[model samples]
Target: MPDFTTDHTEPAADRVERFQAAASTAFAPLLVRAHDGPPFHATIRAQATGGLLVSDIRTSPVTVNRPAGRISSSDNDVYKVALQLSGTMGVAQDGRREVMRPGDLAVYDTTRPYALEHFAAPDGEIRTVVIACPRHSFAAGPDALREVVATPVPATRGVTGLVAAFFTGLADELPNVDASGTHLADALVDLISLTFATPPRPDPSALTARMIAYCEANLSDPTLSPRTVARAHHISVRYAHRLFAETDRSLASWIRSRRLDRIRRDLENPLLAHRTVAAIAARWGLYDAPHVSRLFRATYGVSPTTYRRAHSGGF
Candidate 1:
């Protein structure tokens, strides 16, 4: 892929204006204000890999803002995930704010008002790799996603750490890849989804959320019943059922539904075409072939075989 970069080493008087224009063009239409005084400096080196836009940015202290006027004129409706490589950045959106240090990650939507305050260290420059894509790129609800915007995702552990490492590796090797890099882009999106799919652990008393997290992690275990789930979380089976009383289904039903959904998705995945429907069902802990077929048909209004056929263009 070809690389695109902006050079801000022009006339010192107009460097700030030039940098602002370049920044807006590379990311989105927004206002960039120099943090302290004159002689603003910044650079944006970007590459388009498949459907993803990856950019490495190095800039002095500055605050980027997306105001209502700019949003009304052009709302891109895209999500920007930034991995702080050096220095710190403070992101504010949807009433949430987070200060992202080195190795920290943050996400924000471009359709609404937001601000990014980039702070440099003694080196006088902050570095980051920003990935931008349409909001629909991930299978998540807008409202539900908005709730987590501007929240800092620590890169020291768990899925976020893995994602941070992947981005760092990609940025390092991006100059060598000669193709579209679509597979890499897809993996990045998948990791982002996985990191966010797990509920945020704001407090320990979020037992229901903990249960959902545990269930999602162990969905492939056929023995992942309410008993196992409760035991894993150190709660009683009766209390586990009570925790889900307000939900539409019982704990067991919810797990089964999730497993079935995974199976249905696999059935439609072209990459999994070689696998049989029974095998896919078993992979998700639905070992009973007849029961899986019946439940799948009832949920999707089509048998697994028919669904795969339709998705694969074989019917």
Candidate 2:
């Protein structure tokens, strides 16, 4: 990992400016306002994890903003997840506001306008650790992503606790390590995946939220093969397959399962009771009757027709 460690110990007049310059390059353009007296003392230790930047930071009371113009000029299209190591930090973005305390973290998109206010406690300057996650690393679609964006993800317990621990310890664990961060990257992405995931779309961002969105929108087109998917996304077929490989199912299997799930739902719908199993299957681009039947039974423990019949009629 590439490392950068800096401490702003310059005279009070120049420290804030120097800190602002260093911050802009390390993260993004921000209008930084100091709340404490001048000659601000700050520290930032950041390292690149190939796909993400993990940093440990301590700063005097200040407010940072990524305004609309700055967002436009230098949009990395990445997301920032910051863990409050000590003191209090407040974040506001996308019309949502949150106050994060120790053991609390929040995520905000760099592509959007946001503000972070770090307050100095009686003890000292606010301390925090932040992770700069490339947008592509997130697998959740835009809608699902919204649920956590600018929202506080508590790290007191559950899987979120584990994620918090990872971010908290990453700075110390990764320094001077020469190996690639493939596994580490996957873990960060996976935890972020879990943090933002919800029911009705429980399927994680196996192929990234964008790729999954494209696949879902064209699921019924029949022409939506891996090659076509790759072409549409301007990515190679091998890359597309590799993205799916990150999940428990393959690309073809995922598509098939999604199609079957839709077909099953429609079959059980009273409005679609008049539709034949074959028609329902075709509507979802599943034309192979025997193959569909076999998979459906294997998945749901009942053939498509039987499942539909059992659920369609009144008791």
Candidate 3:
């Protein structure tokens, strides 16, 4: 995150231009104005973590453009995960178009071109959150994930809903988070990975159920150590270890494996062209660059950068 200012008084054209200039280093920009209609207003707040960026945007009716030329020439691939808080909107991508209603989630890639047209309610308001990250961050193979890339992925239930909720909540809380907030970011990534990996289901075992739920709930608290979890459950640390041991895994091992899975998925995404392999790894909580490289190669049988380059068509 960086210092930012808000100006609601400027004319639409000037405001849009300013915003475009500010975001151009990170993304290709477009802002459209509504004419002969209700008042159109927009507020944008953007923050970055590694190559992943989260943007909270509320705007009035306007058309969004992702031109074909820009798509062909841009160095970085963009994925816009849009959550509609209110009103109705439409997105056109790769010759396919879909309209999104309230409580719906949709993803679109910038490597290819797309267009979005939004309509405000009669009361003249449209509110939404748009999280724009490098497409590779989502942790799915490009070919397997592309079919659903720009289409709406409903977050109305289960793991998807939980992950979506966590992201939206973080956007509202990021202003209050500081350097110590790294834990929160880590948890968000984990929850997102779990959400994308597992179908909606209840845990079958009590110990596993409790552990997973607690982990999801306290991902932001760095002090959420194994001791803390043991204490909360009225058990000893040894017992907690035994619980995981019964599953043939340790708590630390599970977490590390989960994090690695996320990194591998992002590395294979075709839409994350602009981000380097190291950047993607760090973004998902693999802090030691060399360690990440070695572990990724050992586990996946390919280096992180090489995997990303092969799948994403990156240079």
Query: Best-fitting candidate, measured by lDDT?
Result: 1
User: Candidate 1 lDDT, tens digit per residue, 107-177?
Assistant: 88888889999988667778899888778888777786775678666778788889998878766766664
TM-score quality measure for candidate 2: 0.59
Candidate 1: lDDT of 239? 58
Over all chains combined, what TM-score does candidate 3 have? 0.54
Residues 1-315, candidate 2: write the lDDT tens digits: 223333454566576777777787777877887786644677787777757878888888888888988867445667888888888998888776667788777788887789999987778868899888887877887676765676666687788898888887785665653246778878888987886565453234644577778878877888777766765553435556878888898877888888888998898799988788888888988788888899999999999888987998931
Off by over 4 Å in 1: 1-13, 73-75, 198-315
- Residue 12, model 1: lDDT of 51
lDDT of 2 at 252: 77
Q: What would the TM-score be for candidate 1 when compared with the true structure?
A: 0.60
Candidate 2 — what's its lDDT?
Answer: 0.76
lDDT of each: 0.79, 0.76, 0.64
Candidate 2 stretches greater than 4 Å from native: 1-9, 177-179, 199-315
Backbone clash pairs for candidate 1 read none
